[model samples]
Target: MSKFTLRFNTIAAALALSGLFATNLAVAEDIRVISSGGFAQAYKNLASAYEKSSSDKLISGWGPSMGTTTNAIPVRMARGENIDVVIMVGDSLDTLMKEGKLVAGSKVVLANSLIACAVKTGNAKPDISTVEGLKQAFLQARTVAYSDSASGEYIKHQLMKKLGIAEQMQGKAAQIPATPVGEIIAHGEADFGCQQRSELLPVAGIDIVGLLPQEVQLSTPFSAAIVSGSKVQKNAQALLDFLSSEKNAGVIAETGLEPVAAKK
Candidate 1:
């Protein structure tokens, strides 16, 4: 072959190989996520922006931090489901790590939440400005509801006891399963609802009654963790890093969660 022909063929091969590599870099790979409703909107907004900014795609799953139902993150993990990352209540993530379900040292606080109350729209909002007022509101409502999530569990097992009205609410109160308490209230299935502020804000026709009194309210912190043996560890870590950054504070707050102090 002529020298020129040989050189031309070699250059073409190199260019083709480089083009293949570049195409691979531009295509985003899927990263799986399991997040509770408490912080679902924040992660969703961040994930959408992350996809636009780069080639890392997000495949998400929704579930509560703790529950026995199919949508519970812990239940899904225990059943051998595959996921790249988990966003859940902080203490629940700690429990999963202790049980060897998540990678050690992979947990990072994402945001803090307040357990808040809501009532149907166009209705007179209840008075929960004081501990006595909260208890009275609970007692006064004909039907009240809470979720099957961590916040619901807290209100059911702890807050009820604190208010000294647990027994009185037994028949009048309902425990909603894997659904937003705000949803139940909005539909008029329940006259009153209590859940994480983040969960409540997204539902329409529910008038937020504000956070419960400090004396009987819960300040729940949330976190994210890397799932063990995830197929997309590097990408998953990047997503976590973005969610935990201080720059995302405004978006996080818009979802009704308070951003924790950015890590040093």
Candidate 2:
């Protein structure tokens, strides 16, 4: 071949290779999502669907309790984790936005879940339908377990106070150190366990008692947002979009969470 022709062919091949590389880079950017345990299972279902439908983006690590074993998602952000997106208690996300950890105006309300009690699948499901019924159930249990998360915190302080039984519950009620609340109940370590409805439903060997009555039921709205300095903003936003969709909302509802009143 002529020298000039050889040079032209090499240049053409180099340009082609560069174009392919860029295309792959664009398509392979996966969204990094950190979320609370309540939404993990439902979000995983949606992530699978989204990934199957897209070529330019993927949903990556769905970190349920991403901060670590000890810290909440907000605390994780304060500790300098590079989270592209976070799904957490809505109000907590608001505080993070105010503190400049998350991008302002980027919050998306995803779903809401309420706290409920569960017992081992074969155990008699206690009636906690009314305020008095709840008190009776609490009094009857040999050991009750709740977590350190939002729902657990509320039960420890608010519910016990409402029933005027904080002092009485001091020894009988235990603050659970970690999750799988239902699993704890299943093992008979706790006569009853309480946590967000979604988190409790999928756990093995537990039967969920109905949600707390309206007078005492606690509903927590969960929201999502991208971190202000995330380099993977595009990928993160794609994840947010998928999670906020109506189709995914149905899946969330089926999994025991209520859909958010409005999308962001």
Q: lDDT tens string, model 2, 130-187? A: 9998888888898999877778878988999998888888898987765567888988
- Weakest ten-residue segment in model 2 by summed lDDT: 59-68
Model 1 pairs in collision: none
Cα RMSDs of all predictions?
Answer: 3.4, 4.7
Weakest lDDT window of 10 consecutive positions for candidate 1 = 23-32
Q: Which pairs clash in model 2?
A: none
Identify the candidate with maximal lDDT: 1
Residue-wise lDDT of candidate 1 within 140-224, one digit each (tens)?
Answer: 9999999888888998899999989999999988888887888899889999889999999989998999898987778889999
